[model samples]
Target chain A: MSGLRITTAAEGTTHRVVLTGELDHETAPELERTLARLPQAAGHRLVIDLSGLALCDSSGLTTFIVARERALAAGTGFELTAPPPPVSRMLRVTGLDRVLLARHPQDA
Target chain B: MSVAGHQVEEPEDREASFSALLEDSMEDLYDNAPCGYLSTLLDGEIAKVNATLLTWLGYRREDLVGRRSFADLLSVGGKLYHETHYAPMLRMHGEARELALDLVTADGHRLPVLVTATVKKNQDGDPLLVRITVFDARERRAYERELLRARREAERERERLQRLTSTLQRTLLPAELPEVLGLEIAAHYHAASSDQVGGDFYDVFPLDADRWGFFLGDVCGKGPQAAVLTSLTRYTLRAAAVHDTDPVAVLSTLNSVLRQRHDPGAPRFCTVVFGLLQPDGDDFAVSLASGGHPPPLVIRADGEVDVLTTPGGQLVGALPDAHFVATSARLTPGDVLVLYTDGLTEARRADGLMLGEDEERLPALAAGFAGTGARAVVDSLAEVLTAWADEPSDDTAILALGPRPPEAR
Candidate 1:
């Protein structure tokens, strides 16, 4: 079986999606569908929790960029939370850390 | 005679014993074979399962037979795939072979297995049941994962190298061309491919208060080795220009440096055009030195395009003592001077002719925008380069300089 799973939850005005397993070219479409289904109303906060994510590739990075654009167009707040060391390193190396807002779960 | 008669009398009893032994062995083999076996009804309901299959899945024969479907034993993703893809394929083709999937055990642990299924047909040729054989794939799955990890690591390593190459390539050129008062200057660098760093480089910097040093060059090859030579050449040219405003002297110093640094066995050489520019009244006095490099094109204020001829020049660092020639040109207020690497002339067109090989091609190209300023000329050339049907196979670098109009200045 492909090693990827996603779960969503709601808290007040914020919608949280927790991702697990490897996120690569093979499974990026599944994540894209999940992001597309998210509520895009103004004042909505969407927080993607990545603590359980094991891996990501260029496709995953592109998906995050698209999600950020969607949230901006709808006037919603978007952020990534609790990315593992490898994911954070990838973001830093690609210079995406400055563009994508990331915070710890406790901080969020 | 009595013993022989007794042996003949027991033959019928012995034949019956042998037939019973063969039947017992066949049943045992079916139940205890190495691979698991199962027969499912058309709707995937478990009709018959061998003891081996039941043991592998940690389930009793009663738990599966007539109760569970084959899809029910799969993980969530496996079940989805089976319903969406494999099931439809099986229905159409009447068989599915070597499908890799995971089976969920009674304890919720997944057992990686490879399955091959064939549809059984009755006498009327209608589907009766599906027979599937399952093989344990734990070792194969582990090996595949290792291979995938190695591939991912290699990709990441290549990405890192590209980043380093791009950053290093940037340092080899000036961050921003120095602002020269009364002179409009523009430059462009076109890389053939991003996988390897190209050795084409250009720089426009101030040598002193009145004079400026500018150059465009292409090394023999590309990547780390050529990049090292490019960096060294850029520094050497700038230093040499400071000591002497003579373009020929600057290139001669560079030629000597290249010859001394690299070994004779693996000689490194470059084609370069070094220039020194100084404001002379209403115009700029330009002295360009060639090291087997293409000559610069000058578009006069009156719309006359001319290519300066610098003869008897040899490639830099090619020999112990290489000669260089300095040519002079004057850039009037509306006139522009353009220097380019060989990549431009060598760029191939669809018809197999080079952009600058013919004598009339470059002059005609410049004539089209004869009165344009430095920036406009550079921008136009860049647009032309990008409009080609195919990308240039080599790196190209261009530098254009013109005196600003009196009113604009």
Candidate 2:
């Protein structure tokens, strides 16, 4: 039982993951399993929307890193966008915004 | 006691009739009772056994009455227990109550049972025979087995956790800091949880004849994965410092190494403050660089505290071409420079608010220990981390370095 919830949807050539609620040590594994099951094929893009994410800790950040690595290795494009204020602040603090959020979804 | 008003027949006639009834049922009751009963001679040879006892053991009465002893009916372990404890206790106390044992049946299957034995003696106090009762205990034995299994499982899990924690501690931390001339260094690590391993680490090592390198950092997570990241960060910084002494260059080298040796399984990122120290004139010159780490504090001799901030520094190993900035300061005699992990700044207050990285709380706390050496500053701050709250959410690491005062010299 974890506080985190994940939903996946496909629109056009993009596979989007929507995360809501807190992402901590206890709940990060749920996201990891969901990311692992994605078909990271070429000619597609993976985007995570974090507008409803209330909290994210160090373990959550690690999951994001692993997801990015996996999608890129499969020759698929990856990006994260629409992060809430607190999560955005954390990304800026850890300097991960440059690596993970280099492009906005609207721009794509 | 007789009831006179409720009497229906003459007292003598009623007594005679009741005696006749008891005589008729005595043998039948002994043979068919729910419990098994046996009578054995002084040497444990079976003298007489009830029909119930014969049926329970799947044996015929003639086969056991003269041939086998009471101990022969028991399993091997039960036989040993009967000799060592049951026999001795019965001999001393004239009775042994509720001794658990297993009985062997005709097919050699074990029948779990409880036995109570008593010595029957004559008027002169010499023992004539021993009477024994056996009760089935299969249900109780099954319950005990389940309890034993659960207890063993918990013990094994605890042992594994302790082994992992100790292994991480032994490999990730330095055994001792190198002694440097004219400089005093002190460090303390406070683990928030006893069983879990934290990601914080710090070390001070000599680079060459005239230069020294030191660092304190915190990896992103806790446990074995964090331990691997910490090991890589520490060794890379140490090797990079030997090749180049500039603080910014050393951090950039670490960033590149972390990016190149990418572990997609677990995140490899950390915040660190790496510093290079060298003697200049009567004081030591320090150049410190940050990889998105908390800035260090400079406590002057007169109780004035200043934060040495390296602005726009990115977290190492997370990005390509991560930027780092180095700040310089001079550590005069009696001045202390403090570097710590986020655990201290993020410590929660009683109202559930963080004591954030601001100019007020930490600097004010350090002002009280102005002009004190590195040991005093580190020891007192460590006490605060222990006493301020019940338990901090994260582990804290503190490192303080300063030169000896003029008076001491």
Candidate 3:
């Protein structure tokens, strides 16, 4: 129940990575490894849906920021969508929303 | 039941031989039973003891019978247990089974044994004598001792690890924050586990005669590797501040250092808030930059709390061109500026709800101690974090800076 599950679904050029369950010190590495393997080409768009994310701690947030960094370096479009209230607050408090949520098409 | 095929010729001879065999077997079984058997009178005097009991204790049967009581064969602790627990339980329950005790041997050595005693009563239910059985427990006692020794060794190793972890953790932090003439400074750090070092670190040091620099940050992972990163991050920040005191430039320098030094396979990154303090005539002028770190909160003297939110800042050391934004705040008298790592906000309440889940929780807490100086604010908040329902899951680091109140100055 406390474990994190990561699933990826691709529709055309947009790839959606859905994260579910708690994301803390123990589960952040799994997300990191999964994100590393995903295609971050210039034309590909990466969207991380946090609706199912029950919890996101420091390590989890760090992993997301690194994922964003990787996407940027590769010139791929990156944005986070559907952040749960708790995760949203975390990003807002840390002022990460400015960078990670800049292109939130749905939440915008 | 007689055997049909057996000879009926020697009935008298068979009866004689069977009687002799039964008598011989009965005596031999009693004298050399695997377990020792003894009977003691109501006064605890040994009336009879089997040959096995005498052989185990290296004594003759007559040596223990009638001359020495059963209590006389017990060690000091065994004698106490016999008189207190063993004797009383047998008297009330009529039997005591499998009581472990040490018995003294004839040669002044201790023999561990399991003793089971039953009171043999008369037909009228009157207590007559006690029949006791003894079994050797040498191997069992030795096994128990070995287990105890191994447990103690494990405990010692854990203690040694904790001590080493804490000592290394201390090196990553400043022993004391430099005392700015007009500003009061305080900081606190709480590690989640003592055995493994946490990744949180903070330091406050003087930059110039009238200026000071401070930073608090948390690395992604923990343990020995994290400690090494923490040490590197702390020194790099200090050295960078020396070259450029601007909050943005200082952090930008750190970002480059971390990205270049850390291995590609194991990328290391951290969330950091770096600030510079300078005296501005009765108040301290503070300019801080955030690299995806939680914004600092301000508590006014009037009991109002404000979050100094700086947007558009990315995590330091994670990317090649990470951006950091600087925000300015003036710490007037009775106004405190507090900076903290995510460990504080990520702390969960007893109900599994994180303290940061409610954005107003920390502001509300800070409002309670409005106008308090840096020391009091840091100490109070530290107390709250320490006594939280479950200790903060991660390492938490907090640093508070405030201008001295007029009355105290």
Candidate 1 ranges beyond 4 A from true positions: A1-108, B1-29
Candidates sorted on TM-score, descending: 3, 1, 2
Q: Best candidate, DockQ-wise? A: 3
Score residue B124 of candidate 1 by CA lDDT: 95
Q: Estimate, for each residue in B1-409, the C-alpha lDDT of model 2 and write its tens digit.
A: 4587675688899899888777477788889888899999988999999988788789999999999999999999999998999999989998999998999998898988888999999999999999998887888888888899999998998899978797777677788877878888999988776677888999999988978999999998877777778899999999999899898999999999888877678657899999998977669999989988877999888999998877668888876678888899999998999999878876766755555534478888888888889999999888877666668888899999999865675
| C-alpha RMSD by candidate, in order | 26.2, 12.5, 7.5
At residue B64, candidate 2 shows an lDDT of 97
Residue runs of model 2 more than 4 Å from their true location after superposition: A7-18, A36-54, A71-89, A101-108, B1-135, B138-164, B193-197, B302-304, B347-352, B357-360
Q: Chain B alone: TM-score in each candidate?
A: 0.90, 0.67, 0.85
Query: TM-score for each prediction?
Result: 0.72, 0.67, 0.81
B41 in model 1: Cα distance from truth in Å? Answer: 1.0
Interface RMSD of 2: 2.6
DockQ scores for all predicted structures: 0.01, 0.29, 0.32
Better candidate number, 1 or 2, judged by DockQ:
2
Top candidate on TM-score is 3
* Order of quality (DockQ): 3, 2, 1
